[model samples]
Target: MATTALFFLFAGFAIACAVSMVYHRNPLYSAISLVGVFIALSCIYITLAAPFIAAVQILIYAGAIMVLVVFVIMLLNLEDDKPLNRLRYLYAVGGGLGLILLVQTFFIFYAVMRAPKQTVDADVTVGKTLSIGTAMYTEYLLPVEIVGILLLMAVIGGVILARRLEQPKLELVVDNELERRGEGEIKDEFRIRL
Candidate 1:
């Protein structure tokens, strides 16, 4: 009951924040909302007993990636006037069709899988971290390290891009004597003295 209640709470918060992220006009606000959504999703994953996934979600998505997004948005000084309203109906239709097919496949599998008639003992189950850690380190260690390195690179890249200096604009200030003599050339346009 507690799990179900927590699931619903986190699920609702995640969906609400996701919607806010899409609809908010301010880029900073949208980025913050997206971070909120990611954090809520991480909580939901934790409630599902997937601690490793939850840790990764919080560490990578909510912590590093969202911070980069927020920094980039702020550094760009983005205005809120334009919203990304361009929608590709074909992509949407294809995605909907794919989701429907995936749901159908799941239902078919669930129907075909027969229930085990044997009684199971819960006490024999290995500790969650022990089994999961063994599998991840032995089978998926390389990929996991590679992903971490990629994420670190992305963070460094984002910081570099965001902190890039803006080009300085040159100002042309011609003196009064030069103006009177018509010696000043206004960016390739010269005027003759009358």
Candidate 2:
């Protein structure tokens, strides 16, 4: 009962933080809310007895990913967004979608809560980091290599797209006569030629 209560509490907090993260106009505030959501998700993972996933959630998502997001936010020096009045219709759409998601979540949670719980014999190698690494390298090697190649291509594409092309400079060299000529005289000469 206590575990279930704690799970629900964390889940609710996670959902609230996620909503705040999406709705906040300020990037920094949104990132901070995302951290809260990650923390809440980690707590939920712990309650589910997946300590490895919980630790990864804290270390990778909450710590490393959040730090990267904050650093990018700081580097970009983002300003506060404009008032939502201009996007009032978007707000209505978002609110309707949020309501639909909430209903779906409630139904899903209710179904999960009512389902029969099954116990499995814990395997020594099941959740170990080493076993996971081994499996990835051995069984999933081809997919991993493909993903790496795709990422490399994406990086190359990004670099190519981001590079700035140098514009050719235009220089005009005038003779002594032309240099001495006034702007009105030059215009008169061009008009006569035309």
Candidate 3:
């Protein structure tokens, strides 16, 4: 009973945070709200007897991914976006789409509530971390390796791009008493990137 209550609590909090994340104008606030949503989802996973998923939720999504997102936001130095008046039609269309989704969600929930019991075994090992890890190593090894290589390539590309973006600009520090054709007047030490 307590577990079920906790699950609902976290689920509700996650929903609320998701809404807040979408509603916020500031990117940083939205990112913070998304972190809250991730944590709440982690708690929900714990209540559902999926500690491995919960740990991943916290470690990967909340910890690593959110850190990257927040770092990028800070790096960009984002400001609150100004609301445009011409986008009202787009807002209306989005609201209509959201209404359709809400109705579809209700229908799906109703169908799910009246559905038959599971045909699969209750004591299945499919959800277990050990079983999943074993399957990844045995069956999905090639795909996993491919993904790892892709991620490595992405990281290398990102490093190259960052270095290129931080190229040093030379500034003239000419001495009044110095003669022409002097090469020591150029200073490349101070880098001002705005």
Provide C-alpha RMSD values for all models, in order: 9.4, 8.5, 5.7
Superposed model 1: Cα runs more than 4 Å off: 81-129, 141-194
**125-192 per-residue lDDT for model 2 (tens digits):** 34456666788899999999999999999989989998875432221223334556655446334332
**How does each model score on TM-score?**
0.56, 0.65, 0.74
Candidate 1 residue lDDT tens string, 57-151: 88999889889898999899998856336766766887899799889989988876865556434433332466677877899999989999999
lDDT of each candidate versus the true structure? 0.77, 0.81, 0.81
lDDT for 71 (candidate 2): 97
Q: How much RMSD separates candidate 2 from the native structure? A: 8.5
lDDT of model 2 at position 179: 51
